[model samples]
Target: MKRVVITSVGAVTPVGLDAESMWQNVKQGKHGFAPISSFDTSRLKVKNAAEIRNWDPVAMGLNKKEARRMDRYTQFAMAAAKQLIDSAGDLSGIDPYRAGVIVGSGIGGFQSTVTEHAKFLEKGPDRVSVFLIPMMICNMAAGQIAIEYKFRGDNFAPVTACATSAHAIGEAFRKIKDGYLDLCITGGSEGSINEFAVAGFQNMGALTESQDCDRLCIPFDKERSGFVMSEGAGLLLLEEYEHAKARGAQILGEIVGYGATDDAHHITGPDPEGDGAAHAMLHAIREAGIEPGEVGYINAHGTSTPLNEQCETAAIKRAFGEHAYKLAVSSTKSVTGHMLGAAGGVEAIITMKALEEGVLPPTVGYKVPDELCDLDYVTEGARKTEIKYALSNSLGFGGHNASLLLKKFEG
Candidate 1:
């Protein structure tokens, strides 16, 4: 199998408009969350989110005319994709057919769907815009990305709930490893912060109803209530190892192994014992040919929700045993809030960056640790250490569990 390397990465997250800006803010533990501004959440229990602020579409290089048509999710994806494409400059030398784009989203164009549905009811079906279906479908992100970059090899979307991006990226790794394509842009995006989503999560008791927006997303804390809804997008340029070396592309990191599994247990909740998640960890480690002890840091799937944090902790203990206690595991969600489908993409970047910089990001808001979740969550701020191997985990609805193992580039 040919080796796959991540040459470049870009992000348009609530924390920042681009990767550099986002990383700087997140590293400083600066919270981007505040009272929701897109809608009047005056009557709602949770009125805050990690909403992207001060982001004018034109600021991201999008014209007002073009920005008017795209929904928030597409805008974020486009911004991230543009940055990644810029990083992989002068792709004209490579055949467009050898390039691909695979973006994922659990919910796509949600705002578009709701708006068009209202229009259909108020006006007529004919009043719906021609771009309604094409724009609102979950696969449209991938289609739009391919069209923007003229990538012709592979274009598709992965929708596995929050595991959506992990699966997309993992599949991209396989495509490159099998020599299917020389370069591929893969990641995920989501923009589902709406009244409907809030009502649903609130009814199901899966949302943080705290009035303090700044401290609502307290992942892994003993008093952690629920996940703070957020929106964002992340894109990564993946290329074959020799192809990247030949072009002297900056290798961001090497994706060594990927593993995915389904629990067949529940639709909304993870298995209490974390059987599915543990299996994913085992599979990824085996594929990487490494012992449990080799993994120095883990970007955990800690969503600040009670079930996920507890269950994921159980899974980690089951998979790594004593090594789990020795490793540094932190949930970037604690700092960035929950991005739903885009969660995996941001966490993947976090893991790769930790490997690159040898600094583990702290999981903020960890006031009182739970007994069942006994692990060193790197809470004493960023720690500088040798991170030879890093693992990123994501568990989503439908019992989806995805794990990706990354290592420092050697030889």
Candidate 2:
């Protein structure tokens, strides 16, 4: 099989609008949790989230008129895609037909749905805009990216709830490995941090109700209540190893293995036994042809929720056994909050960066470790550790579990 590697990364996360900025803030153990400013949370129990403050598309070189047509999710995707393309450099030589885009979103244009429905109910039929359907669709991010970059190859979005982007990245890896495409823009973008989304997760008991920003998203902590809702986008430029080498592209990391499984347990909750998650991790490690001890770091699916942290810890133990205690595992969600669908994308970038820079980001805000989640979660700030192979895990709603193994790029 042909090799696949990550060439560039882009992100519009709560911590920063770009991957480098986000990584710096994340390494410093800064948490982005704050009071929700996009909408009034006076009527809701959950008043805070990891929101991207002061995002202006026009300032990012987007035309004002064109920006108005796209939903916030699409805008975020466009911004990140631009950054990825720019960072990748001179894709003009690569055939548009040989390129692809696969950006996923769990709930696309949720704000559009909420606002448009209210307009329809208030003003009968003709008031709804024609762009409503295009804007609100979950696949529009990928579609719009293809339109923007003229990538005529495979273009689609894999909506697997929170595991959406991880699936996208894994599928892109398969395509590139099979010589299906030379260049692929893959990741996830989400903009569901609106009144409807917050209210829904709040009522479903998925979000943290605490108003204190410092203690909001304490993943794996015994006092952790729930995940803090957030919205953002993360995009990666994936290229075939030969293609990237021939073009002199700076390879960031090699995606050695990808594993996906279904829990078949619950729609909203992960399996307590972590059978599916463990299988995913094991499959990824086995596919990479590495012993469990070889994995030096893991970006866990620690959502700051009791069940998720406990289940993921169990999964890690099952997959890594004794080596699990030796490896450094941390959840960047402790710093960036729960970014829903975009979580895997950002976390994947973090894993690759850790392998590249020999610095492991800490799981910020972890005060007391839960007895059920007793693992070497790197909580003592950022640690200097050389990581050869790292795993980024994402377990989403609807039993979707995905894991991607990234190896340090030597060349």
Candidate 3:
């Protein structure tokens, strides 16, 4: 099989606006979740969120008019794409036909969609802005990035709920490996923390009932309850290994394996036995031709939701046996909150950072770890260690599960 590598990464997360800022906050065990300020939350049951606070996309070099027409989610993606391209240098040197984009969103511009719909209802059919459809469509995230960067290759925007970004990245990996594209920009974005989204999560009991500052978003903790609504975007520049080497591109990590599965049991709940989740992890391990023991750490899909934490624990144990107890597991979500579809991509960056920096982030707010999740979670604090390989799992609503394996770049 052809080799694929991640050349550059960028992020717009609750912790910060770029990958370096997010990683620094992650290392310090910072919590981005706070009472919602983007919108009035006086009456909402879940009032706290990990918002991309006071973000001005103009810092990413986009003009006001252009950025204004874009919905917040798309704006975030565009900003992140700018960071990615800036870090990767001028892609103009490469063939435009050989470059492509694959980005996704679980819920595309919920705030924009709901706002425009309200306008139409409050005034007349013509009250909705002309940019409504363009700004609200999920594909626009990928489309806008491709247009800005002059990438004329394949562009896709998968919508698999939370699994959206994971599938997008995984599929892009296959494309590069199969020789369909030489360079691909891929990742996920989300900006759905509006009234409707918060209400929906609250009605479904997905957000924590408690407003306690320290108790919120405690993933894999004995008192863990539900996820905190969050917003952000993560983008990765991936290239064929030979193409990267020929160009002297910096390699962050190699994509060794990817696996996706469905619970086939419920739309919102994971299989209690972790059947589907385990299959995803095991499939990744088997595809990489590596033993479970080879994995040194896991960027867990530990969403801080009760069922997901428990089921993921079962899945890890089933997939790795004794190795499960030895591996360092940490949830970046514990600090960044849950970026939904973008979780996979952001966590992928975290895994690569861990490998490169030799520093493992601790799962903050893990005062009392759940008995079911008995593992060396690196919870005491950030620890310096050599991580040969790492796994990042992303499970979304609708029974979607995805796992990706990233190895420390040796070339």
Candidate 4:
């Protein structure tokens, strides 16, 4: 199998608009959760969310016409893709057909769909825009990215709910490792912070109802009620290790293993025994050719919902045994406020940065830890430590479980 490594990264989240800024804010334990500003939330009980503010697509080099046809999620994906390609330097030597995109979103163009549906009700079917289908589909995030960069290989979106981007990235790694592709753009993006989305989550009892910014999404904490709804995008440039080395590209990190599984227990809830989640982590660790003790950190899928945190804790312990207690485990969602489909992609960036910079990002807003989730959570801000291997976990709706293992790039 060919070795695959991350060459560059791009991020657009509530914490920061770019990769460097996002890393800085993450290390500082800065919180991104606040009230939703994109739409009115006067009627909904869930008001606060981690929203990207003051973002200008045109300022980010997006053309006016293209922006109009795209939904906010695609816009975010394109913005992140441009950032990744630019940071990767000149890729002129690589064949565009060998390089492809695999970005995913749990809900695509949700806001656009909601608004257009309202027009259809008010002014009949003729009032609906012809671009509605292209704008609202879940796969357009990947499609638009491919169209923009002229990438013609293995382009598609993996819609596994919250595991959406994690699966996209994991599959991309497999393609490169198995000699199927030379390079790929992979990650997850989301833009569902609208009234209808919020109302649906609120009605389903899935969103955190807290109005306070600091207490919104307290992952693994005793007071954690549910996940905070948020929106953003994360994109990564992945290349064959030999190709990256030959081009003199700076390697960010190496994705050594990927594991995906399904709970088959519930649609929105994980298996109470955490069997599938544990297996996902164990599979990733085994594929990385490393012992459980060799893993030093984990970016947990701690959604702050009671079920997710408790089950993830059990799954970690089940997978790593004593090493789980020793590892510097933390949830970036505690500060980033659960970017839904984009969670895995953004968390991957945070985990890679932790391995690269030798620091552990904290699970902020955690004061009283739940006994069920007792682990070495890095709650006291950033901790400087050498991390040879780090794992990022993402458990999504419909029992989807995905884990990715990354090793520090030494060569």
On a 0 to 1 TM-score scale, where does candidate 1 land against the true structure? 0.97
Candidate 3 per-residue lDDT over residues 319-361, each given as its tens digit: 8888888898988889998898888888888988999888899
lDDT of 2 at 234: 91
* Local accuracy of candidate 4 as per-residue lDDT tens digits, 1-411: 999999999999888999889989989988888778887888989889888898789988788899999999989998999899888977888888789899999998998999999999999999999999999998998998888888888999899999999999999999999998899999999999888888988898889898778888888899998898878899998999999988889999999999999999998998888899999988998988889899999999999998998999999989988888899889999888888889899999999999999999998899886889899889889999998999999999999999999999998
Residue pairs in candidate 4 whose N, alpha carbon or C atoms collide under 3 angstroms: none
TM-score of each: 0.97, 0.99, 0.98, 0.99
**Which of the two candidates, 3 or 4, achieves a greater lDDT against the reference?**
4
lDDT of 1 at 279: 89
Report, for every candidate in turn, its global Cα lDDT versus the true structure: 0.86, 0.91, 0.88, 0.91
Q: Model 4, stretches more than 4 Å misplaced? A: none
Model 1, span 1-411: residue lDDT tens: 889888899898888878877776666677677888888887688888888876677788776887677877888888888889888756778888989888999889988888888899999999897778777888887887888879999899999999999989999998988889999999899988988788788889988998786568877788888988889898888899999988888888899889899988999999998889988988988988889899998899988888898999989988988888899888888778889988888788878888888888888877887887888888787788987998999988889999999998775
* Model 1: per-residue Cα lDDT at residue 138: 81
| Cα lDDT of model 2 by residue, 1-411, tens digit | 888899999999999999999999999998898888888888999999888899899887677998899999999999998888888966778988889998899989997898899999999779998899999999999998898889999999999999999999999998998889998999998988888878889888888898789999998899999999888999999999989998889899999999999999998999999989999988888988888899999999899998999999999988889988999899999998888888899999989999999999999988886889889999999999787999999999999999999999986
Q: Which ten residues in a row have the lowest lDDT in candidate 3?
A: 89-98
**Candidate 2 off by > 4 Å:** none
